[model samples]
Target: MDHYSFDQLPHAVSELHQKLDSIQDLLLESRQPVPQTIELMTISQAAEFLNLSVQTLYGKVCHREIPVSKKGKRLYFYKSELEEWIKSGKKKTMSELREQLPSLVVGRKGRRH
Candidate 1:
């Protein structure tokens, strides 16, 4: 039969306790509040922000063209995503207008010989 050393037992037990304490502290710290810089908006609030009718917003959501989340019976949106959608729509409109500009300018200067 092999004999165990008594001197090593206390050190091992103390190390185990320290590890447990560290794990407990980590778990406690994870429960702390995280600071959110962006605010979440409800569907109605988002629609109002975009100056869109609620029905139009709902249609976009149904078409999966807009970013939205459904929690229970209510819908939610991130303010940033809504702003991005608005900006992208504006960009598309600007591009379309630019494409049509040549047709709108009827007067052009001819080269003089």
Candidate 2:
């Protein structure tokens, strides 16, 4: 280890203090609670959240086309699951498909040349 001269002690202390402050900020940030909360909604609320009419939502539920939970006679929807359901219906663009083609070709075996 290098020895610090007397005049350098204050500068070294200030540098150490700044490092400690940065570490403390990181520690405090990691200790904070996550903000994800499970939100359950009724059929009507789910319809409004998805911007669909109640009748359309019912049709989707009857056809088992959307994520849902049935408890007794009432139906429930989780906002997170609904969000995922919407994402699952997304269509890939041509550029996305092209980007994936190389990986797709690499995974295949026994190709005829």
Candidate 3:
């Protein structure tokens, strides 16, 4: 390794500290699961999560409006699938209109006028 003289030491020290901070952040992130990676919920938990009554939740399951896993008499719901089902019902807000643009707004090369 190249040795840093006293003049270069202070600046090198700051750079080393920044590198160590970034490594620490990476280690912490590796220990945690992502927001979307959640546990499966029971019928009661799923109903509470979706802010619906148990009867309403059962109605949804019967109507096949939501995603669920059935094992014998038990029902299981993944938060991710439930979230996706909710997202499927969402209509685009006015502010999100640009997201459905036919052309690239920031056209590259000869595409832009």
Candidate 4:
């Protein structure tokens, strides 16, 4: 048999209510629709994000140099995709390449010159 003193009753009930409220909140949140984390930007918004003129952005889009999405007559860009596109063109400077040459020249399969 479980023994409950008067003082324990209020504490147990309060704890139970708090746990039930937490469960209810979790259920409600689960039923709601989640918003997308990656927001799609309009052409003008994309240009502003990239610090480019709208015309320059359009030209890049026309040349397939930039990532874009087309819906009917409009264009859209994902900020995440644009960031990746920008990173794709990253190149090491000449000095950096020169610094790496000695290590690359070592461990050669052919005879050293």
Candidate 5:
């Protein structure tokens, strides 16, 4: 260990304190609760979240049309997957379709640009 003179003691202590403060900050940050990525919902909760009737939801589940997880008699849905399922049925606007047309036309049997 390097011996510190009396004059250097306060400076060394301050530097040590700063490093401790940095470590404490990191510890506090790590202790913070992380946001949830997968939110599981029951069938009734799924129906409420999706604004659909329970009967209709059951019909969709029976037909294997919607994203679902089945455990014995219980059905589970993930909020993230349900949101993505809703987005997957989105109809493109005319402008959106036009924007995608060029990419779709390239290297296909059609009139060249």
Candidate 6:
């Protein structure tokens, strides 16, 4: 077999090293940890989390009807606040509604015959 020249060997080794380094960089990038910082929820995600339809969420945002923060074009919500607001708006039972309605409704005595 013909022997390879030393000059060619160094070039070949350097190319191999470069290829290995590129592969290592790619692997390192792949292994990098995803950031744990709160990922701003997309409008869809927010709606799903709130159990509301997209249109409702959009309406609230447009009217400034909901508490939110904006950064550039993105809207962010505090999850805790959203959860608290939902909890506070929990629907009253039928009995609870009945109890509340009597005070607002005029009795027969108060109504004009």
Error of 3 at 105 (Å): 16
Q: lDDT per prediction?
A: 0.85, 0.96, 0.90, 0.94, 0.95, 0.82
| TM-score of every prediction relative to native | 0.47, 0.68, 0.57, 0.55, 0.66, 0.42
For 25-81, candidate 2 gives per-residue lDDT tens digits of: 999999999998899999999999999999999999999999999999999999999
Candidate 1 shows a clash count of 0
Best by TM-score: 2
Candidate 4 lDDT over 1-113, as tens digits, reads 56779989998889889999999999999999988698899999999999999999999999999999999999999999999999989998999999998887885756657
Off by over 4 Å in 3: 1-38, 98-113
Clashes of each: 0, 0, 0, 0, 0, 0
Candidate 1, superposed: residue stretches over 4 Å from native: 1-36, 92-113
lDDT of 4 at 55: 100
How far in Å is the alpha carbon of 73 misplaced in model 6? 1.2
Model 6 residue 60 CA deviation in Å: 0.7
lDDT at position 76, candidate 6? 80
Residue-by-residue lDDT tens digits, candidate 5, 31-103: 9999886899999999999999999999999999999999999999999999999999999999999999988
Q: 6-109, model 6: which lDDT tens digit per residue? A: 87888888988999999999999999998766546777788889898989998999997776788899878877667777788789999999998877685655
Q: Is candidate 2 or candidate 6 better by lDDT?
A: 2
At residue 1, give the lDDT of candidate 2: 78
Supply the global lDDT for candidate 4. 0.94
What is every candidate's alpha-carbon RMSD to the true fold?
13.3, 5.8, 9.5, 6.7, 5.8, 17.0
Q: Pairing residues by index, what is the TM-score of model 5?
A: 0.66
Error of 1 at 41 (Å): 0.9
Highest lDDT: give the candidate number.
Answer: 2
Off by over 4 Å in 6: 1-40, 91-113
C-alpha lDDT of residue 54 in model 2: 90
